[model samples]
Target: MATTTRERLISLLSDTNEYKSGQKLSEVLGCSRTAVWKHIEELRKEGYIVEAVQKKGYRITTRPNNLIPGEIKHQLDTKKLGHEIHYEESVASTQEIAHQHALKGAPEGSIVIADEQTSGRGRLGRAWHSPKRSGVWMSVILRPNIPPQKAPQLTLLAAVSVVQGIEEVTGVDAQIKWPNDILIDGKKVVGILTELQAEADRVNSVIIGIGINVNTPIEAFPDDIATIATSLKIASGKEVERAYLVRAILEKMEKLYHLYLDHGFAPIKLLWEGSAASLGKRVRVRTITGELYGNAQGITEEGVLLVEDDEGTIHRVYSADIDIPRES
Candidate 1:
């Protein structure tokens, strides 16, 4: 990944504690001193606090709390997952951009991310509330050499990655609801949507869209979802760093994805089931066909939900909204 001029500028400013002279910056960045000043102004407009003195040139005192590529890729420890990042200030959806990139043969681990999603969506076309700079709204493109039918397992894998990532970052014990929801204290803090581009037998690419409510406050949620949706800030009582969380999730996803490709879904499934919240409970699963009320059994090898309804009937649920009933 070739670094942009702005990225190089940021790197230079961030690596040292003392200020960098304009002449020194221009010499290292291979640009005119006027151009270096323009870049510093641009950084200021993007919410970066670049302190400049008459003789002491410039130094970045603070960076914006946004998911700009420069901010995320700075010291990001990942082999492939976030090497190629497409960052936008606001977009309808990162998934839409990821699909286009995938069709154009973007490499695996290329990610599309945004500060705000104007038209973010969840499973079943539900509107996902993604305010600007309040959450982690991103999509990762992966070209895995596996059957298309095995794609759903990646959603489970992503859920596990997110659960582990959230715990690692915020010390919040997040749990996975069936399919693709991560909850803390029984309120949703993250959502995952996996889409695939495949031919009959060969898989082209898989786009995993992960939306995490990082620093959003409780009152910011819409009235309809306010009761059920929560953010990491609300759960952990501290402002979670969105960029760090994104890096952590990408690292975890890369590791788990390799594990799945090498060992199979057995290891991933065990890790997923360890953090599942709906298992071994009475729940109601609402599918497109109808609603089924039953005991929440374990997932199958293919990541299908197995729910045993009354009369000892086990229904295989490929996709559905699961609701775990509270104990009476």
Candidate 2:
């Protein structure tokens, strides 16, 4: 992967605490001083705070809270997950864009990310609330050579990745709510949606959309979900840097993805269970056909939810909305 000048510029500025002169920057970057100034201006436009002194030249004092690709790539340490990124200021949906990219032969690990998503969706076509620059709105494309029946395991894998990522970057102990949601302090903070492109019995691509309410204020949520939804800033009592969180997630995703490929879903399932919130609790699962009340046992190898009802009947829930009681 070739690093762009802007990425290199970010790296250079980030590598040291002292200011580098414009002439020196131009010399190192192999461009004229005027071009270096233009690049600095571009950085400012992207919300970087570059301190320019008379004799000391320029140094970056602050980076934006948004997920600028250059900033992310400069800090990203991943083999393939985020090597090819498609970033947008605002879009209808990263998942939709990723689907288009996948159809055009976008390689595995290609990701589509955005600052805001107007039509972001979750499982069962629920609208995902994505305000401008307040959350992690991204979709990762994976082409795993697994059977279609095993695709649901990727969703569980993603949930674990998100939980670990949040803990790694923000130091907030996040847990997974059966299937797709990540919660902190018993409130929703993250959502994962997985879509698949397959033919016959082979898997082509898996688009996993992950949305994290990073720095959004509690008041920013819609009234209907204000009481139930929370953000990382609220949980940690400080503004969480989106770029660092993004890099952490991609790195974890790439690592876990390779682990899944080389080994299998067993290891991923163990990690998921370690962070699961609903297991071993009495709960109600609502499927399209009906609702069943049971004690959440655990997940199967195929990523199906196992619920043991009152009659000692263990039911395999393929797709459903679960409700774990507060008392339980």
Best by TM-score: 2
Candidate 2 lDDT over 222-284, as tens digits, reads 999998899999999999988889889988888999999999999999999999999999999
lDDT tens digits by residue: candidate 1, 294-317: 998899999999999988899999
Candidates' TM-scores?
0.94, 0.97
Candidate 2 all-Cα RMSD? 1.2
Model 2 alpha-carbon miss at residue 111, Å: 1.2
Regions of model 2 farther than 4 Å from truth: none
Q: lDDT of each model, Cα atoms only?
A: 0.92, 0.91
Q: Clashes per prediction?
A: 0, 0
Using lDDT as the measure, the top candidate is 1
User: How does candidate 1 fare on TM-score?
Assistant: 0.94
| Model 1 / residue 23 / CA error / Å | 3.6
Cα displacement (angstroms), candidate 1, residue 124, comes to: 1.3
